[model samples]
Target: MIIDCHNHVLATALPPGHDRFVREMRAPGHRRAGRLPAYRPATDEDWVGLEGDLDPIDPGTLVDDHVSAGVDRATVLAVAPSTYTAYGERGTIDLGRVTDVDGPLEVAKSNDYIASLTRRHPELIGMSAVNPKFRGVEWARDELTRAVGELGLQGLKLYPMYDHYAPADRDLAFPIYERAVELGIGVMVHMGTSSAKDTVLDYGRPGALDEVARHFPDLPLLVCHAGFPWVDECLAMVARHDNTYLDISMFATKSTQRQLYEFLLRARQLGCPLSRICWGTDYPGGGKPAVLLPKLTLVNDVADPGAPISRLDVANMVGGNWARFAGLTDWSEQETLEQLEAWEPRWRDS
Candidate 1:
């Protein structure tokens, strides 16, 4: 029942001519989406060290790692960078040049790949991504319908900052939101600073989701990363919106865990239900399971006796709450713990 609510799979291959395109985007003094400080060119050693490092590996290996880390389920998301930028900017701009301006098709392929992965691995739930800015409204709607309806993806992910659209842009994004409501699936919105160079930072602020939540109060919405630096604002949004959730992805470090625990304590004082919070690693960004598990387990160790957070809170944050939120019916906290203990002998008896 440990449902990891957010993570991404690497593209199987770099798009043709993307190397040349990135080089051009990296011309002196010009910021580019792909130019994050953490960027490193892939190498043979990276490929060989897949189990220990960030190198892309097969889905089976991803599942094995999750099991070793005591996770029972994980949600994988698709990303479409071309949807984040217009022809002049970083994300979509370079892709357009490389793909002969057919960048949207690449996005479709990514979504298709994730869908296929989910089909092969039921333990891995798939979330489909579409850029309303890259494709027209009708196309966006159709792609979403295809992903959820035909492809059977359980949710949708929208990256307004990477895709260069404001989350509050009702005119541009409402149609997709409307469709999500009709489909009975959740939507995950990326909120907070994106690694993409020069992307619209303001667009990702947690408050931006307030309008949409107000507009579609019934649609399940997730604010990924708990909106990072804007954590207080994120808490407010979750407090006001019944259907909104905050996931602790990318907050797997020990220091950030303390920040999150404090935030959760404050949220409880404000009468916000603990159920609205969920766990996520943002995977590759949060590092591998071995690196992330101890950071996550720290929440369990530090649950002060009289604090709002309890040992039970740690259990729910890791998986129980997510199962209920994600509409999973087969999960049981006791059963999950037993199964995980059986799988990972290192997990101490609870």
Candidate 2:
């Protein structure tokens, strides 16, 4: 089976006014959450190309495309942003995100949409989202419980930095993590820097998840984006913690296949189990299958010089790892080389 461990159905993935709010928040002299921008925006051009990013395409069609592309299964996460905090600062700020001002209703709606998608397509796995800071830890915990028990979501998706909360905060986030452990579901956390201008960079680091991994050993932590720019640190944490895994969403693409191969090679050298690494494309928003799928096989070409990443490694990276990690007992190794040999020539250079 070919499985995509990270993806988003844009229709319900983003809250209303999210794009407009973020644009307004980045205006000159607007007060941001953590520190000033690490790299401040120069002009509106910096935020260009985001118009299509928030478009609400049909989730069913999205799944259909994946099916046509030979992806047997894909996991979609609910996008739930936290309420903007009330702090003393002499600067301007707008809505920032619809969820930033509203309570947990949007989160529920998002999860409901995701649950519906999963129900419609058994090939899709749903992950409910929660922001412990804005809605209160108790509410977040209860929401996750409801999502798993009633909504049938298989996991939790968290945006610690974009939502302005310390991911490692024992009091704030631990309760939610505990709920996942009790519910027997995995957690997908957005690690590394966020493109959102209002996000708290201090909270976005992959190292903070180290504390979470150590605390909740039973909770499967899938660090999204491979913690890019901080790849070494992220891989080191995966090496240190058996419960931690990394997903190459934005990190792997046709243009960056060589870089991803090098990272995988480094992973082997670091003693990080290749089985814990999963293939993912942040479809509809970040990376998509058309731009990333071919690279999944292309990386093998670059995995050389020593203990290279084998075809088996490529298979595990694309499907087996996620199936095993997510307890997907039904997923089998159906995409054998013999079955895909016809497309092998198409996945190569002209």
Best by lDDT: 2
**lDDT agreement with native, every candidate:** 0.68, 0.71
Error of 2 at 130 (Å): 1.2
Clashing pairs in 2: 1-334
lDDT of 1 by residue, 139-202 (tens): 8888889988898888888988766788889788898899989888888998976544546889
- Compared to the true structure, candidate 1 yields what TM-score? 0.79
lDDT of 2 by residue, 1-350 (tens): 78888886644323444545434433332323322343664455654544553455456667887776667788987776444532212111111232222343343466666776788778889888887865688888888888889988888889887667789888888888898899888888888775555668877678889989999999899888888768788899899999989998877742377777778778888888888999898875554575577787666666666756677777778888887777677655555444345556765642
Q: Report the alpha-carbon TM-score of model 2 versus the true structure.
A: 0.82
Predicted candidate 2, C-alpha RMSD: 6.5
TM-score per model over all chains: 0.79, 0.82
Clashes of each: 2, 1
